[model samples]
Target: MKDTKDSWQDSWFDTCAALLTDPQNLRVWSVIVSLFGDLAQRPGDRLSGGALSRIIMPAGIKPEAIRVALHRLRKDGWIDSARQGRASAHFLTDYGRAQSAEVSPRIYTRAAAAPEAWHLLIAEDGAGQTALDDLLLAEEYFSIARNVALGAGPVPEDIDDDLLVFDASARTVPAWVRLRACPPELSEAAHGLLRDLSQADALLPRTPEAISPLQIATLRMLIVHRWRRVVLRQPDLPAAFFPADWPGPACRAAVFDLLDRLPRPALAELEAE
Candidate 1:
C-alpha cells in the first residue's frame, strides 16, 4: 500500500510538471483562468485582491510577476481590473475566461462565440504552423489589424470604408484593401494602395503598413476570430458563411467592395507574392 501511494504521488507530480512546461498552456494565463474559474464557481460574484493573490501565490509565481502578467492581460483585453482600495481587483473578460478553459489538446481549437460585432478572416500560408513567438506576435498584430480594418488614426483616410488586407508572401508585404463604397474616379485606388503597400517603406514605423511583421501575425489570429464568428452567427445567417449575408446580398456586396478597393497590383500580387 505504501509503495502504491508513492507511485501515485510521483505520477501526479510528473503530470503537473508537464502541464507547467508546455508553452501552449501559457502558465501565467492559466493562473488567471483558474482564478476566474474559482470565482465563477464561487457562491459570491467577485473576488478580492488579497484572495486572488493567495490563490495565485501557491503556483510558484512571485508577486511582481503576477502584477506584470495581470497588467499585460488587461491591456490585451483578456482581463479587466478595478481599483479596490490599494489593490487592483482582477476579473476575467468573457474572452479571457473562454481562452483559459481550453486544455492542452484543445488549446488551438475554437470556442463557441460570445456576443460580438463584426468579423475578420486571415488566410495564412499554413494553419497551426507557428511557435510561441509567432503566437504572441499574432496577438499584437490582431489588435493593430482590427484598427487598420476599421480605419484607425495611424492609418490613412483612403481606407476609411476599406478593409486592409495584408499579403505576406515576400520580403515586403502589401496591404491590399477594398472599400465598401467607391466613386467612379477611385476605381483604380485599390491597385494603387496595393502598389504602395508592396514598396519597402510603404508603412512608416508605428503606422499601419502593408508589410509589418505585426500585421502578418494579426492575419493569423483574425482567421481564428472569423472562424469563431462564423460558428456563432451561423444559426442566424441563412446562406452559410461564404454565400454572403442573408436577405438581399449586403454581405456579399461588402466583401466585393473590399475586394474592389484592394489595389489592382496587390490583388495580382497575392498569388505571386
Candidate 2:
C-alpha cells in the first residue's frame, strides 16, 4: 500500500510539472532565475548544488543543463558560486537581485487594469522614430506605429521637443489597436497558460500540507516560470486596449490562487530534504 501511494504521488507530480512547463520553449537560465526569485531572493540565501538539482531535475531538465546554465549565469555576473567542502552553493549577485527585484511586483502581485490616463507621442518621420523606439523598451509606453507611441504620466521636458505629444484617453477603440495591444500570439499564450493553470489546480492536493516542501518548491517554480513568460511580454494597459476575449485577468488570478495554496517554503527546509 505504501509503494502504491508513492507511485500515485509521483505520477501526480510529474503530470502537474509537465502541464505547467512551457510548451513553446524552456530556457534553462531563465528557469533558474525564476526558481531563485521565488525561493532564494534574500541576500544571504543560497541553494546548494544538490538542492538545486533536486528541485529542477524533476521538470525534465538534465543535470548537464543546470551545470551549463549555472556556468553561463556566473560568467554573466548574475550569480556567484562558492565551494562548501566538496559541495557547491550558489546565490544571486547584487546585479541579479536588482534585476529580479524590478520585475517582482509584476510577477507576484495581482494587478488590476492600469489607470486610464494616457498620452501619445508622435515623432518626425526618421530621427524622431528612432528616439521613440527607446521608450518602448525602457518605459511603459506602447508602440502605435513606427513613429507614434502611447504612454502615461506627465510629459517630460527631457525628450526631444520636436516630437508631438497629446494627453488623451480612449473614447473609442478600433480593432487594429486592440490587436496591437494583445496580438494573436500573445492572446494564444495567455489562453494556454490559463488552461495549464486550471489543469494544475485540479491535480494538486486540496490540503497543501500534504505535499512535501521540495515538491511544493518545484511546483511553485514551474508555475512562476511559465507565468513570467506570459505576463512580462504583456503590456499593462486598461481593459479597453485588449481584445474582448483576452484571458490575462483570469490567468493572473489562477496563478496567484495556486501560489497561495502552496505557500513558499523556507530555503533550509527545501535544502535539507
Best candidate according to TM-score: 2
Clashing pairs in 1: 177-262, 178-258, 178-261, 190-262, 190-263, 191-263, 191-264
Q: Give the TM-score of candidate 2.
A: 0.96
Give one digit per residue, the lDDT tens place, for model 1 in 1-273: 989856654444333323222122235654555445433422223445555554444334577877787778788887787877886556667776665554211222233222233333233334322332243243322221323321112332332132434432223222232112222223232223223223312222222342322222222222222222222222221122212212113322332233233212221122122
Model 1 ranges off by over 4 Å: 1-26, 41-44, 98-273
Candidate with top lDDT is 2
- Model 1: lowest-lDDT 10 consecutive positions: 236-245
Cα lDDT tens digits for candidate 2, 144-258: 8889888876676676677898888878878999999888988998999999999989999887666899999899999999889888878777788888899999999999999
- Candidate 2 residue 63 C-alpha distance from true site, Å: 0.6
Candidate 2 wrongly placed segments (more than 4 Å): none
